[model samples]
Target: MRITRVLGATALLFALAVPPAVADSAPSPSASGDDAAPTTAGTSFRTAAEVEQGQQATASASTGDYLYWSFPADAGQRPTVRATVKLPDAHAAQSWQIDVYDGLRRRQACQYGAQTRTAAQGAASVDLSCTLRTVRSWSEPWANDPLPGTYYVRLTALNVATADLGQPISASVRVGSKDVGGSAAVDGSLAEPLVPGIAVTSKSGEDDGDAAKSAVLAGLEPEDGWASGWWSDRWVWTAVGGVLAALAGVGGYALTRGSGRPGRVPPGA
Candidate 1:
């Protein structure tokens, strides 16, 4: 089947109506919140080798950190494909695209629509010393095709101006049921969480001191929503206490002034 670019763009915009972004080095998500290491870092996977060969499409744009995606294991059943993209220090991507492929190597799903597209592939795109902006997470649906088999999800970055696919990253999924034009089924595959790990890179140079300080500073800094939430709570309690103290003061003054006053002090006695 000839896939029209217009249809693909339409689908992409529909999916990107709600863009999803998340930071790299975040813990993998599971129903239980546990994480498992990715089978292959920064690459696509498939149940069978033949399937992998078909989805090897590349793009021009690269991601700042990393991208995450998932799909249902059953065919014909709707699959929720969640993805995240982190931006450089102050620079953000103009738009992005997430593509889902069925067993036949056809573009089954897509999510795009960002303004800024980065030229670098990984951490280099952003100055890690400062705050990191990211698209958290969003979902898209897929159809049951190729008779309910394995599929892949490719999250591609696009230049908002030129409408070009930059660098594409992808992951694999299995489809179980036989549904089409609809959603995935219960037999769809779910991923295991990633095992936690840390990367220890050395810093030593004329700028080593600055890099070291920056690393330390980043750790001390709060996340995007952390400080706002904390300060809001603090101010709320402070206001409540102020109101209570004012009420207490008024009560105390009234009691003190009336302590020894005669109740029947008349004017014309």
Candidate 2:
């Protein structure tokens, strides 16, 4: 009976340990699932259609027209952009390409996949894809490394016959991302992703000059001198100015305060 009791106890402990093991082994879901599929694409970054990682964006555009789509990418994610263009009927051989650009409008190099493809004469469609490098949690501002931000996919026909320039063509694009796990994490993180849709509210009743960040972000940032044009210095200067102003007011009050105390009349009142 003792042996059976010990065996049951062992089984219970094993069951208790199984949850963390299962959770650790499960693959993380793609980060771009918050948005829906885009029915049409944008002509530029400002108007780019927004879509999630798995959602597909389709647009009815001309062969030579530029199609643009945007999606959010987080740190440690390796994003791959895939595009398909349906060639117009009875058109000559045409070439198409897919390009990815970061939020700064800088073009990103593809780590793999066919970024450009040419369709044969009378071909129905052409496929193009670009797999980008993993997004970094932090990096130097001068470096062109991929950081957490909004990414854009641009599709265009490289070469098309004059007759096919305005020909009706169908275009589709999808961005998919893979989580690279904690190994890709860095010591620092971006203050915010480079998505244009994000906005911070300004503090009310504060000076327009750097006062917006003087209290909050500046407090958290390092005070030691670093580089010029750094916003942190603005906070430091504002704080010093405020302290000096307060000291001046206090000194003026002390000097101007009458020597006689209130309600204390001297000699004959």
**Using TM-score as the measure, which candidate wins?**
2
* Residue lDDT tens for model 2, 1-269: 44455445555644653322112111233334424456788998777887766667788998888888887776667888888888777888889999999878889999999998989999999989898887887789899988766788899998688877898999878777766644455567766566553323133324453544433221111112111222222354456556556655655665667564777588986
- Mark the regions of model 1 whose C-alpha exceeds 4 Å error after superposition: 1-41, 44-72, 110-146, 160-269
Where does model 2 exceed 4 Å of error? 1-35, 197-269
- Evaluated against the true structure, the overall lDDT of model 2 is 0.69
* Candidates' C-alpha lDDT: 0.32, 0.69
Report clashes for each candidate as comma-separated counts. 37, 0
Give the Å error, residue 113, model 2: 0.6
TM-scores of the models, in the given order? Answer: 0.29, 0.63
- Tens digits of per-residue lDDT for model 1, 84-156: 4443333334444455554345555323222233435333232111111111111124532322233445554
Judged by lDDT, which candidate is best?
Answer: 2
- Report RMSD (Å) for each prediction in the order shown: 23.7, 22.2
For residue 58, model 2's alpha carbon misses the true position, in angstroms, by 0.8
